[model samples]
Target chain A: MLSTLQDEKQDPRVKRTRSLILNAFMEILPEKGFQSVSVQDITEKAGINRATFYAHFPDKYALLDHSISQMFRQEIEKRMLDACHYSDENLKTLIVTVCEFVSNANSHCKPSSLQFESLVEAQVKNQLQGLLQVWLEQDDSDVDAKTAATAASWAIYGLVLQWSHDKNKKKPSAEKFADQVLPLIAVNLRLAQPA
Target chain B: MLSTLQDEKQDPRVKRTRSLILNAFMEILPEKGFQSVSVQDITEKAGINRATFYAHFPDKYALLDHSISQMFRQEIEKRMLDACHYSDENLKTLIVTVCEFVSNANSHCKPSSLQFESLVEAQVKNQLQGLLQVWLEQDDSDVDAKTAATAASWAIYGLVLQWSHDKNKKKPSAEKFADQVLPLIAVNLRLAQPA
Candidate 1:
């Protein structure tokens, strides 16, 4: 999936429209809750017609999902986690990425609407599962890569979600938190082999 | 959901058959990974007919889901985590319950098969969502209870999943692991309002 995305050849016009729509959505997302953001609003903000918006994303939720997925993918790619095989260090970086993503996502809106949270969850989990599968497939394990990926994806998302919610004045930074939970998460990845 | 379960009245024969089916499933799950455990196997183990098994559950997957849900619920109720509201201590107990549940579930099979992991995940995440919803409803906060509950539920399941996967010879016990993660999990519960 990462390779396909990296090498995709797209018409400049299509890319331009999609980018415009995403930028508009990101701008309005923090101002209006996800549930309140409308297709018309996005179209107006992006200086495009409603039809153009629909051509790119069927609805605002899809736009949100796509945007979040893209932003998160970039984060993963930035850390080079997307191109690497499973390693303790790579896994640690993955955790930090998720932690930062969740914290940043949460802080963007005044109070995160239900629609926003669920969309983010779906997008993040999907990508995490995909990336984990790539790493797992490179190894020979008795357990299925897809299932291991699913479990690990869920676990990584959960750990970051929990870390992002921390309100303690002394709550550890994402790096520290990721370091603390590293051992636990690395275990999920190794579940393909018996101990 | 808990209330519905507690107050339910059922035909004695119906209840008995369901119990028999569940018992048979529990006995067979470890022996035959979740994927290989057929309805025929469950019925033969339970001394019932295939039609009777179908009458209770759609298929082996449903049976696995139902049985795991019941067992995890029992685990929660046993810890009395089900009958409580949001509190740091209760959250700690919830984490402990999940850790124990994951560790014990992983230990049941030689290699935690893909089917086994997925089924356990579905059951655990569902119950965690329900339990977290109960806790969130008792609090007053800016965040939506259901959304908060959903995120928190996923995080808890993921964290425990990671903790259970740890292969370190000196890994912290479930209780100790829960203690370490309690603050992070507890913060998710208190997201609604400042306590």
Candidate 2:
């Protein structure tokens, strides 16, 4: 399924419109920024009418949302689940998966289609908030799981945020990052350990 | 110091103006929204002159920033930091500190200081950006630690955004919340551990 996306991205028409809209998005975003992106502007740039653009996407925000959520969902969710089991090996694998996932996603989707600033809270938080809720539910009834989940979920979110912000030369290896960050997560899981 | 501060909050004149500003802030927030708050409005309600108000704060945004950051730095950081060795505990504490700080800051600052809609990347990313750069410069060079820090920081920032947009009960039980969140940090730290 993932491999199929690379093939799909090769379509010239898809590439053209998506690129045009994205270019327009970038131009508008840093200027008037996210709040100002208009459907007409995007359509005009792509040389398509409002109707044509609407057929492709419901609205400017939705198109931008889809571009980001679609690109990274598979990788992020996979990391969340892969990190579910408690073992050193599992942990190491999860770290690489996540850091690499973030790195790859940044390389592929960024400067367009995946600018984090433009994300609306409810839209972006849906999956992460849900993931945290489930994780916090295990062996926990005392604390507000949602809040805990929110904190934990966000830490990973922070990790990714931190990863993407660096203006590195050679680029930081995601594997080493996984190593540095993984230890921070281990202490919280002590509560969930088998009694 | 804490007792003196508490006493000051109880003084009649201070209490009245403070309450007035806080109340006005809440009412204006949902209606005119965050960025729209004005000096005249705040002064009118508080029954204070602009000069007097300025004595307390440089501007409305500064007041809001101080309010939120004050609540967070005092309450959340005290709990999350172990002030100990450079191990998993240190990182978890740091992560939890960040998540909780953001969570608390977002709660108070949203309608007041945290006008994400109005802020540019320069302001939002500036101080934190500098701090992350310092933390990432080390043998840990393999990781774009600064970027990772920013990403993680923003994730917490993002979570707070989600929380602000949702309906949740507000109570200042820092201990309860911190205990709840510690595990998720543990998990992430564990996952990020090096081989």
Candidate 3:
């Protein structure tokens, strides 16, 4: 699934084919949603045959997984978060990024279903855990990096999800919200002294 | 869904019927797994009519949700953690409770699918957040109770889940694991002094 992120360095034809499928999928997702958007719809929109579509993706769920992962990775890279270590500043930026990503996803996908939301949550959290694990391992924290990262990733995703769903017209902006919760999340990564 | 927990204080007949349905569902869940266990299977197992089952729960998913919520609440109540204010000791016990509950759920259910795991996750996390929010609110912390609880609940659930799935022979006991990560989780609720 992560390979999809590096597809740009793959064979040109494969890259172009995948791009077509992904672009078609993004276009149809808002119209039909993840659950209802059929592979045939993507094929038709991409101007590719069923065989070609299948060659690129096993099915629409895999396509959604790939698409979500790529999109989230771009968000992380855009802020250069993928290259940074654990810090309060970086963590705050990461939280804001997740908040905006989830908000965009909630609005972009019309009438998003629970299943679709869960899929997005799973994909985004998985990547968050991986990225956080890398960042924590580069630091001197004595806690289990994998476990800490897992906890932090889930916390970030869950908080951002709640923030996105807040119906209050006075809801804080993503940056402001991130600043408020940054300490709670940062402690997960920064706690415990080097043994 | 939480109302199911208070059914004990409701009419006796309602309590009896829910107990019967929940027990039958638990019995069939191990044998047939959540997805394959139909309402018919549960009804037959409980020796109750379809109408009786319907009168209790709208569908199996609701049954699953109610069952999980009740079970998790019982775990918290059993430890008397639900009645306590925020403290490191209480937090450690809560983390241990979650670890054991998740471990038990993973082992009790047969052929647990991703969907089943996710449903359990959602149900357990909901109850955890509610419980933690109450605990945090009773203390003098200035952090938003809802946001702090949301992040703590997800972190605890996510960490315990990782511990449960650890296939290594040296996986720490739930209590030991909880002790190790208590500070990481405690800070979420304890930080941000009262105004």
Candidate 4:
């Protein structure tokens, strides 16, 4: 569904303008806080006029919401597909995938500002929830399967959040952590369906 | 450590002032992004002079940072202690504790913006890293325990983050999820070493 948003026939100018604004937004996040940047700043940075920017995005913050949603949805889709094959041994794969997505979702390597952080995170959270929902439905009725899937999705997202801004801690591979957690989840849930 | 900080209290007036400012900060986060709330807004809400506000916190953002740090530390401590009793069928008492913490930390009854979607997640991440560093001090030759710890901590943190935020997602009991993760963590990293 996320990938389906694109239309090859849409106005070329609209796509170009939107891409330019997103690039400008990403560049500015590392250098300045989101609240500090203005619509004028974005238009100027993107080499587009105020009207051109507005036509594509209502305001600078709108651009951020759009970019974050689209990018997160895309990344989650990809990760979920790749995650289809994950088992206990190579679990770090999923963590790495999610971490890269979160890290990249931030404007540059910076933490998302208070301005759009919640909205963006909400979208990301929804995407993860959607993915988990689908993963849970794959197997028949086991109440605990749904719980495990939910745990898997949130656990990965939370870990990425920690890794992004945590200063005092050393980093870990997300995949391995996921592997470690799955069995614990499985045991506690006592799933009727065999994995 | 957090308990220590809360105990060696300063003037009641100082405590009252800080509480006022932090409450005001949470009040405005939903309406205005964290990046937008100014010191003046806080002062006006707290019914304090700008000079008095500055006497406590350097600025609006600094107050947010401080508040977030304190909040993250507080939750980390609570979760660790609450989860310590990983009894029979308790399913990683740690995981359950964090889920319970998230579920309870912000509620409609109390409505804590300190636990707002974007704020303290980073603090949780960093705090987990610190915890892992302490927990993974075991003498393992195969993997660098620090990296392993970071990975393990992040994974658990991520799990809880998702669990906390998923309003609609079916969540397992804190005991169930923790039971799932804690043992796997112990096994994978050999965290079973005697502490």
Best by TM-score: 3
Q: How far does residue B70 in candidate 3 sit from its true spot (Å)?
A: 2.0
Candidate achieving the largest DockQ = 3
Q: Would you estimate the TM-scores of all the predictions?
A: 0.53, 0.47, 0.82, 0.59
Please give, for residues B1-195, the per-residue lDDT of candidate 4 as tens digits: 122245575888887777777777667655565545678887888777878998887676567667667765666565454233323332255456556655654552243443243455555555655655554453335544554454455456665765566665555566655665565444434432221
Of 2 and 4, the candidate ranking higher by lDDT: 4
List ranges where model 2 is wrong by over 4 Å. A1-38, A45-48, A51-59, A76-94, A108-115, A118-129, A132-148, A168-171, A191-195, B1-31, B35-195
Clashes of each: 3, 37, 0, 17
Can you tell me the DockQ of model 1?
Answer: 0.10
lDDT of 1 by residue, A105-158 (tens): 888865686457767877898899889889988866665575457556775786
- Estimate candidate 3's alpha-carbon lDDT, on a 0 to 1 scale: 0.83
Write candidate 2's Cα lDDT for B52-171 as tens digits. Answer: 777666677665554444444454336533223334445445444554555543454445432433242223333334434444443254554444444434433443344444555663
User: Which candidate do you rate higher for lDDT, 2 or 3?
Assistant: 3
DockQ for model 2 equals: 0.26
Q: Candidate 3 lDDT, tens digit per residue, B1-195? A: 223456245888777778788888888898888878999999998888888998888889889987887888888888998788878888888888888888888888878876678888998888889988998788765777888888888988888888899899988898888888787777777663321
Q: Is the docking of candidate 4 incorrect, acceptable, medium or high quality?
A: incorrect
- Tens-digit lDDT track of model 2 for A1-195: 222235543767766666666666545554444445578776776667677676567666677666556545666665566247335555456556546655654454435332344353333345555654665566455545555445544555556545556676754677666666655543332333211
Docking quality tier of model 2: acceptable
Candidate 1 local distance difference test against the native? 0.73
Worst 10 residues of 4 chain A by lDDT: A186-195
Q: What order do candidates take by DockQ, descending?
A: 3, 2, 4, 1
Model 3 interface RMSD over true interface Cα atoms: 2.5
Q: Least lDDT summed over 10 consecutive residues: which range in candidate 1 chain B?
A: B186-195
